[model samples]
Target chain A: GAGVSQSPSNKVTEKGKDVELRCDPISGHTALYWYRQSLGQGLEFLIYFQGNSAPDKSGLPSDRFSAERTGESVSTLTIQRTQQEDSAVYLCASSLVAGGTQETQYFGPGTRLLVL
Target chain B: AQSVAQPEDQVNVAEGNPLTVKCTYSVSGNPYLFWYVQYPNRGLQFLLKYITGDNLVKGSYGFEAEFNKSQTSFHLKKPSALVSDSALYFCAVRASRLTGGGNKLTFGTGTQLKVEL
Candidate 1:
C-alpha cells in the first residue's frame, strides 16, 4: 500500500519569501496532520484536518502559517513571509480515523526547508 | 498538558548486547504512548505503541516496549543490538479523550542510539 507522500524533499528559499509544502495522504485516510522539526529538536505540531470539518489550527506557530486540505486527500502547509527561524523539516502524517485516542498515524518523508 | 521525555541524549551498545532506550511521559488524562525510529535522511518509522491491555507490546523488526503506569514509562528494548539499529529514537504521547478536538501528539527531544560492531 502506498504511504503518505510529500513533495519537494528539500527546498531553499530567501528570507521573507513564502513557501507551500504539499502532502498526499493515503487513500481513505480522513485525518491529516502537519508537524515541524528543527535541527536537534523534537517534532512540533502544526495543523490538522479531519474530513471537511473546520481544521485544527491551534498548533500553527503564528498567523503567517496556514493549511488546507481538499476533501480528505491532499493537504498543503503554507508559511507566509518565511524567516530564518522557519527553516526546518516539515513532516506530514495521516490516519484512518481521526476520533480515537489510540489511532495510529503513519508519517511521510519530510521536506527540508532552508531559509537564507 | 501532554509531554514526553527521553532523558538520555544518546545510548551506545555493542552488537549482540541487549539494548534499551528509555522513555517517560506525562498527560492530563489516560496516555497513549508510542515509539518511533528515524534513520538519517529518512522519515520516522513506527516501532510500537501502548494503548491499553497488555503492559508489554511487540512491534516491527523485533522491537518491543514495556508500559509502566506507576513510573509513566514506556521504554523500547531489544534482546540483542545490531549495527543497523543505529539511529535516532523518539517517544511520543497523546491524551486518550478526544474532547479538545486537537488530539495533537507531544514528542520527546529524542535520543540517538549507536550500535557498534
Candidate 2:
C-alpha cells in the first residue's frame, strides 16, 4: 500500500518568511501527525489530528506554527515568520487509528527547510 | 513528561557479530516503547515496539528488544550484524493512553550504528 508522502523535498527561504508543508497520509488512515527533526532539537512532535476531534497542539513551540487536516486524507503544517531556529526537516506520519497505544506510526520522507 | 535517552552517540560492530544499542526511558505512566532506524536522506523506518504482554518484542529485519520495567529500558539487539545495518537508530516513548498522554512520541537523540565488514 502507499505510504505517507510529503511535498517540496527541500525548501530554502529567508528569515521572517512563511512556508507551508503538505503531507498526504496513507489511504484509510484516521490519524495524522507532524514532527520536526533538527540537529539541535532531535525529533519533536508538532501537532496531531485524530479523526474529527480537536487537534493536539501542545507540542507546538509557538503560535507561529499551526496545522490543519481535511478529514483524514491530507495535512498541511504552516510556519509563520520563520526563524533560523525553525530550520529543520519536517516529517509527517500516520496510523490506521489513534485510539490505541500500540498503533505504529509510518513516516514520510520529510521536507527539509533551510531558513537563511 | 515522557523522555528517551540513547546514552551512546555511536556504536561500532563487525559484521556477523552480535550488536546491542542501549535505550532508557522515563514516563509518568506505563510506556509504549518503540525503535526506529533511519537511512541517510530517508524517512525513519519502524523496527519494533513493546506495548504490553511480552517483555521481549521482535521486529523487522531480525531485530529485537527487551522491555525492562525495573530499569525502564528497551535496548535493541540483534544476534548478528550486517554492514547494511549501518545507520541511525532512535528510541521513542509515549505515555500510555490511560494516563491521558495522547499519542505524541518523545524521541531520543539517536545513535549512529556502524557495522563494518
Candidate 3:
C-alpha cells in the first residue's frame, strides 16, 4: 500500500507570500496531522483532523498558520504572509484512526519550504 | 501537556556492538511512547511503540524498546549496530485517549546515531 504523500518536495518563496502545502494520506486513514521541523529543533505540532470532526488547531503557532482537511482524504497547510521564521520542513502523517490504543501514525516525505 | 526528552544529542557505536538510545517522557496518564528514525532528506519512519501490557516491545529492523513506568522512560536498543543504522532518531509521547488527550504526538529533540565499522 502507498504511504502518505506530500507534493512540491521543495518550495522557495519570498517573505509575505502565501504558500500552500498538500498532503495525501494513506487510503482509509481517518486522521491527518501536520507538523513543522525547523533546523536543529524538534518536530512541532501544527494541526490535526479526525474524520469530519472540527480540526484541532490548538498547535497552530499563530493566526497566519491554518490547515484544512476535506473529509479524510487530503489536507492542506497554508501559511499567510509567510515569514523567514516559517522556513522549515513541513511533515504530514496519518493513522488508521484517531484516539485508539493501537493507533500509529505513518509519515510522508516532507515539503521543505524556504522563505526568504 | 505531554512531553518527550532524548537526553543524548548523539550516540556513536561501533558496528557489531550493542547500541542504546535513551528516551524519557511525561504525560498526564498512561504514556504511549514511540520511536522514529529519519534518514537525511527523508520523512520519519516508525520504529516501534509501547502501548501497554508488554514492557519490552519489538519493532522493525531488529529494534526494540523497553517501557519503564517506574522511571518514565522508553529506551531504544538493538543487539548489534550496523553502519546503515546511522540516522536521526526521535522519541515521541502521547497521552492515552482515556485521559482525554488529543491525537497529536509530542516529539523530543532528535538524537543522531552514528554506527561506524
Query: Best by TM-score, which number?
Result: 3
lDDT of 3 by residue, A15-89 (tens): 999999999999999999999999766699989999988989989999999898998899999999999999999
Cα-based TM-score, every candidate: 0.97, 0.98, 0.99
**TM-score, candidate 3, first chain:** 0.97
Expressed between 0 and 1, the share of native interface contacts present in candidate 2 is 0.82
Candidate 2 structure quality by residue, lDDT tens digits, B12-99: 9999999999999999888999999999999999999999988999999999999999999999999999999999999999888889
Q: Give the C-alpha lDDT of model 3.
A: 0.94
Stretches > 4 Å off in candidate 2: none
Output the TM-score of candidate 3. 0.99
Each model's RMSD to truth, in Å?
1.2, 0.8, 0.7
* Residue range A1-116, candidate 1, lDDT tens digits: 99999998999999999999999999999999999999756699999898978988989989999999999889999999999999999999998987585588899999999999
| CAPRI category for model 2 | high
* Model 3 segments more than 4 A misplaced: none
Report the C-alpha displacement of residue A15, candidate 2, in angstroms.
Answer: 1.4
DockQ of 2: 0.83
What DockQ does model 3 achieve?
Answer: 0.92
CAPRI-style quality class for the chain A–B interface of candidate 1: medium
